[model samples]
Target: MELGLEVAEGPAPYTVLAVKGEVDVYTAPRLREKLVELVSQGKHQIIVDLEGVDFLDSTGLGVLVGGLKRLRSNDGDLSLVCTQSRILKVFEITGLTKVFSIYDSVDGATAS
Candidate 1:
């Protein structure tokens, strides 16, 4: 599946990247590239809104973790706004739910 990204203004100088679509090995790299560029540009605080995502695999999880690591290294933060049960199950099973801050909604993620 293809990925769609939309940037919206969030709290302060944060940029909320609203991501929609399946995030697997193929598409995950695209996200990683964008996030890396953003981080390099000093845009550290980011919220990845996964509310529209329908599927996620191990590669996708890796992408999220990579982003978190990159942000943390830059003294920034990365959060998630995912409400999908199936996706949430993967995060829980992989213990990523604790690694990445998760919120019930995009608004909440942006707010926090």
Candidate 2:
């Protein structure tokens, strides 16, 4: 499936990035570029909504980690919005569940 990325301003200091589709090596670059673009544009607090993602690989995880690091270095943070068991499993298996704040919904992510 094709990757889709929709970015929007969150309640206050957050930017919500809604992503759907496969996020393997092939599509991970696009997501990384979007994260870089957002950061460059001064959007520090980012909530990556992965509820629609059907597949994710190591490359995608690396991208998220990189984005989180970048944001944190800027005194900001990166959160994730995801509820799919399959997708959440990747984080759990990789121990990234503890590294990234994973929320069930965009609203929940934005609240924190």
Candidate 3:
């Protein structure tokens, strides 16, 4: 399945990227592209709402990490909102749960 990306402005100066569908080798590049575009647009504070993502792979994780690095380089940050146990397991197993600031809801992510 193809990935669906929705970009929107969130609280104050933060940008929100809501992603749906699966994120794998085939679709990860799209996510990467959107992230790069947002960073290029000088949008450093980003909230990635992955509540609709059903599956995530190493490449997807890499993309998120890359996005975080890019934002942090600009003195910004990337927060994630993911509530699925399966998807959350991927982050836990990879120890990325410690790398990114994760929240259960977009509201919570944006508030922080």
TM-score of each: 0.93, 0.98, 0.98
Q: Candidate 2: which stretches are off by over 4 Å?
A: none
- Clash count, candidate 2: 0
| Residues 34-111, model 2: lDDT tens digits | 999999999999999998899999999999999999999999999999899999999999999999999989898877
| TM-score, cand. 1 | 0.93
Tens digit of per-residue lDDT, candidate 3, span 1-112:
9899999999878899999999999999999999999999999999999999999999999999999999999999999999999999999999999999999987898777
Backbone collision tally, model 3: 0
- Model 1: how far residue 95 lies from native, Å: 0.4
| Candidate 3 residue-wise lDDT at 111 | 75
> What clash count goes with each model?
0, 0, 0
Residues 40-110 of candidate 1: C-alpha lDDT, one tens digit per residue: 88889999988889888899888889999999998999999888899899999999887998999867876
Give each model's whole-structure lDDT: 0.87, 0.95, 0.95
Model 2, residue 33: C-alpha shift (Å): 0.3
